[model samples]
Target: MKFYRLTFLASVFLTAVMLLLVYVFDSAKHSFSETNKQFFQTLIISALILSVINYLVVDFLFNFYGKRQIQKISTILPEEIRDEESNLNFKQLSQKFTDLNLKNTTEIDMMKEMEFYRKEYIGNISHEMKTPLFTIQGYVDTLLEGGVENLAIRDKYLERIDKSVERLLNIVKDLDMINQFESGEIILNKSRFDLNEMIREMIDVLDLEAQKKNTKIVLQTTSNLMFVNADQQKISQVLLNLISNAIYYSNRESATVTIKTKVENHKVLVEVEDNGMGIKAEMLPRIFERFYRIESSRNRSDGGSGLGLAIVKHILEAHGESIAVESVYLEGAKFSFSVAKAI
Candidate 1:
């Protein structure tokens, strides 16, 4: 409507000016009676035709260019494309394209990361299994070659075979648990319980193992019976994993592992810290990953399944909580997690 209106006004204005010019210039050459009326009529008809032509051309060009741009953008982002009736302008479409481009870039980066992790995960699993499998095979081969006939080394070889089998079983069980957690198959049975008491119970269960290394399990907290709302059994497993890690990794002849708890911000903050050989800064981020171990401690013959921290992570995530670790290279390592306070 505006285009047509502007065209009409322009055509009328030009026609009026032309008519005035004709009168002024041709009045000297000829009389302005019959000739002037004919000229005026011709000019009026020409102006009306030109106005209609201008409106049609302008409207066609505008619609054609607008629809073409919309089509091009829609090919890339079909879901984000607006309907024909929408009042989307060129600037709005450009902004939408920018946003879509950013989202696509981010998704691509994430896919690349997941691919890297997938390959690494497969490699780690293969390496972990092959080490024990080959050892067990070698022991069996030796036994078959008459080592079993000699009662002296026979028992030693058998014990080593049993330990290898146990390690393999632990890895498989831990992997299964991780899969169940990831698939949401393990449902947590939540209950209100005394968290301090539970920690003490864990310490008691691990007393013998700690005694072997002369590691002291100390409980340091503001209260003796801090209550928490969580899955009691699952939380106990978490405590066992963390405290045992501290004990196993302690490098000193006599190490002190402290279990501390305090009520903070409607939650109980629990920390299991050990004065052990702390982890390096670079290894901290990957510590919770399955089968990931620091190179320095990788050869240490410990009873860990290498999935303790991973299990702890999954269990805490199932409880809708997070766990964190802090450590210096040679000072000590601390693992902390929060639980809901029983109100």
Candidate 2:
């Protein structure tokens, strides 16, 4: 923006200088007699018109430049802006930045904050992984020490240990998957597929688990035998993740998870509803955040790695879809998301 301003000013200044030189030369050669007064008046008018036009053009151009710069900052700066209230000096700096109307500087600081946050995220994920690992290690150690002597008790502890290990592995895998999605390293292999077929297959795969929990898994659609053009594998992953989460979080020993689809406003609405531990009002805004989890009855079913929903959100967005969640505490949670209808 500064460079543009400088170049604009320089060109305007040069043009004004040439115009001034021409006016002075013409005026001097013609002299200031009554016969030449009209010509002098005409020259003055020309100079004033030129100045006004240049001023208006420069003003319009600069305002455009400022707006465009701010827009660019808004796009890339949210990840970088830090709002640390604990540090007085840093807080003051941020406040002064806002008060000073130093927009460009604000954007630069935002980038710095984002880099800091990336480091923070990595540490958080590592710590989460460490907890389950320590638990598994403790269980294994106890079994080796004494529990291994008892066949029946040893089997129980061993199974729990395996569960813990598997949970840890799932967390690690989900993190890797989210990383790939965010980095755009995983390209979806687009293919034609039946939506009902995909949902039915997931139901089949998870049937035993549902039976174990005595849950009823159902799929309903207003449109019969609807087909979609999409990356079958990627879309299936999305359904699997949502369905699995619904099954895990439902409140009752025997629960219902319903997948409903319909055409609304020229788009496909795919909703997964569960009568599970619903999300809190506060966590609703942040449920899709990477590593964010609601600490309540939902965690009882399974501790979330926090990356699953975030991955789902991004994956849908990549395919031009939008996802949202609604919940009534202890009643259940419903995830209503949309994808562009197959054309």
Residues 264-284, model 2: lDDT tens digits: 886678999999888888889
For candidate 2, the TM-score is 0.64
Q: RMSD of model 1, in Å?
A: 7.8
lDDT of 1 by residue, 296-323 (tens): 4465235566788899999999989999
Candidate 2 at 286: error in angstroms?
0.3
> Which parts of model 2 have CA positions greater than 4 angstroms off?
1-104, 146-154, 296-301
TM-score of 1: 0.75
